[model samples]
Target: MMKLSMLCCPLLLALPLLAQAIDAGPASPQQQETEGWLLLQSRNLAASPQPQTATPTERELALQRWLKKYRYEIPDFYDPDAGGKVEVKK
Candidate 1:
């Protein structure tokens, strides 16, 4: 019984190693399609132009309107630039 247990123990340990050796080759068709879709999406995202966002002046004006609507007192230190000259780089 002792000798049988020793032999069986090694065989049981080797079974998992043998299972891992079996290769399931290439990815499935669904997996390949999913990968291709992801690649296309990434490429499209890279190629697309950035959406138009609010400028500093527009943001400031929005904030001023919000403050007025809420009836919140503007702090004395809060100096807003109303139509300030913005330097544009050539």
Candidate 2:
């Protein structure tokens, strides 16, 4: 019983090491290529595109669109006439 326990102790310790050596198989080439392309495209898009000058009115409209999209809840003290005062009431 002592000899058997000693032999089984080493095998039990090695079980986890053996399990980790199993290969799940190589990743598909298409999946790899798609990931590479996405990474490249994201990098290219992140670089500033050709800067196009916009009129003052167009700029204000763009800002308004951004504010609306973000749902900026302004407070009572926020006077639109007193510049862009963004107040949030908790």
Candidate 3:
């Protein structure tokens, strides 16, 4: 009888702790990526917010495109219809 009491004591104590809980939690994504573009300004405080006259360079365009692919392409990361075969869209 002593052995039975000891075996059940821990579980009995834990039962009450489990009773007081909330529901409806959102599941987190397994893979997540955050991407953004940053512009560095010269120490000339007067040059704040450079005029948009100049267009992005070729390399800059490529980098921005690459960053957009990961940032805006949500389906590629968390596709519900991928059926266990998640494809990484380039």
Q: Give the range of the ten consecutive residues with the poorest summed lDDT in model 3.
A: 31-40
From the highest TM-score down, the ranking of the candidates is 1, 2, 3
Q: What is the C-alpha lDDT of each candidate?
A: 0.80, 0.81, 0.61
- Expressed as tens digits, the lDDT of each residue in 1-90 for candidate 3 is 999999899989999988966555434342221111112233344464667464568778888888887765445476576667768999
Q: In model 1, where is the ten-residue run with the lowest total lDDT?
A: 18-27
Better of 1 and 3 by TM-score: 1
lDDT of 2 by residue, 1-90 (tens): 999999999999999888766456437888778887788888886455788799999999999998786686657786768676689999
Per TM-score, the best of the predicted structures is 1
lDDT of 2 at 6: 100
Q: In model 3, which regions exceed 4 Å deviation? A: 24-90
Whole-structure CA lDDT of model 3? 0.61
The best candidate in terms of lDDT = 2
Measured against the true structure, the TM-scores of the candidates, in listed sequence, are 0.38, 0.34, 0.22
In TM-score terms, candidate 3 sits at 0.22
Candidate 1, overall lDDT? 0.80
Kindly give the stretch of ten consecutive residues in candidate 2 with the minimal lDDT sum: 18-27
